[model samples]
Target: MNNTVVVAIPATTANMGPGFDCLGMSLSLYNEIHMSLTPGFINIEIEGEGAEDIARDERNIVFCAAKRVFTEIGESCVGLSIKLINQIPASRGLGSSASAIVGGLVAANKLTGSRLSQERLLDLATEMEGHPDNVAPALLGGIIVSVFQEGKVHYLRVSPPEGLNAVVAIPEFHLSTHSAREVLPKQVSMKDAVFNLSRSALLVAALCQNRLEMLRVAGTDALHQPYRTKLIPGMNEVIEGALQAGALNVTLSGAGPTVIALTDGEKPAVNDAMKGAFQRAGVSCQVKNLKPTVEGARII
Candidate 1:
């Protein structure tokens, strides 16, 4: 088998509305990676995102993931050279890290003669990520609803409907996932739990059935967003403006510092309004219009 392995993984948005650590969807953005074996030495190269800040040594998540795969199979690898062509922004609530973990595992699996099945790979990825929301969708693509219980992941993938689009407003600042989760309450009331449950079910049904009206109610979350709002300035205003500008619903993308608005035909207006809201709040951000996808990680 050829030692050279190349893979492409997509960017994703997690915790869409009320799904909160359960729902995630893959976006059009992608990161391409190439890996090869070397002897007694390692070389790391990157083209975009976290080039200077990301670990260049064995501590890197990509390298760790690849190493983990080898360890799991009791195989010995001399060294590794990783080339990453990254497009997803780091710490932007856009699933950049998830893609990296997936890229490494997939490349190592291919180089090792595909010893592990995709299901096993998924479990490994989720374990590395500490949650299945982001990695599950990054591995399988599409709109994913996942439940992680007893070290196993149960998931359903749904294709996004036509004319249903997303506008992502990414702020200039970065909020690490650790910091974002720290702001969350240690425990939530049952009322909030039930609230999120009902909306999560609605969200999955609405996105699959193309019921735009349901999104407004389906996206509101009392479990996390309400508490996390304090971490993001002008959060409510941005959500309100997007809805007024014709977006069906607006919510924080993953943690905070980036906001996403769900739209149908008013993508441009919603984009403008989201940007304008951030601008009015004295925050600088970049906006992008992206379509959800059905593709996942694979070697080409």
Candidate 2:
């Protein structure tokens, strides 16, 4: 087995409206990690995204994930060297942490003869990430509907429709996932629960059946988006503007300061509308049109 490996993990968007902690889709954007085993030393080099904020030593999430692989497989690595080229923005709901965790696990597994199976890797990733929503797609790619059940992650991957694309309006500020979760109430009303359940199920069906027009209904949420809107200035305007500009659906991307719109039409118009709405609401943001990618993490 090779002692070094390069893994490219795609950025993922979770929730996709009403699926809350269950649905996610991988985007074309990626973060690449070049990892190698070294004796008696650990080093990490980060370029792009959270270069200044991300830890560079053993405490780094990449290193911690790689170490988990070695521990799980009963192998020993004296040290590790990790180089990250981050294309996905950090803490803006783009699955940056999931990419790092998946990249580290994949790269280290390769370096150590790949003792762990993909299922095992998924389980490990879920353990680290606290949920399978983002990590499932980051590891397996495409659209993933996952749940943590009976101490394991059960997931199904749905192939994105031929023309489906995402327009993401990313705010300049960061919103931590912790902060977002804190805003959520401990127990939602049964009416809201049923509301999300129907929409989440509809989202899954729409993706599976290639029913693009149904996405607008599927993207409506009654769970987290309503409460978290205060955390993201102009969230409602961004969603409304994107939809008005012909996007099929729009929602907060993961625990977002980023809003993503799914569109098979007028992507540029949707992009401009999302940006303009944020600007009108006194928020500065950047927009990117990213395609859905079926490919996940892999050695390169």
TM-score of 2: 0.98
Give the distance in Å from residue 59's predicted Cα in candidate 2 to where it truly belongs. 0.8
Model 1: what TM-score? 0.97
lDDT for 162 in candidate 2 is 93
TM-score of each: 0.97, 0.98
Candidate 1 lDDT, tens digit per residue, 173-241? 888899999888899899999999999999999988999889999999998788777777888899999
| C-alpha lDDT of residue 66 in model 1 | 93
Clashing pairs in 1: none
Model 1 worst lDDT run, 10 consecutive residues: 262-271
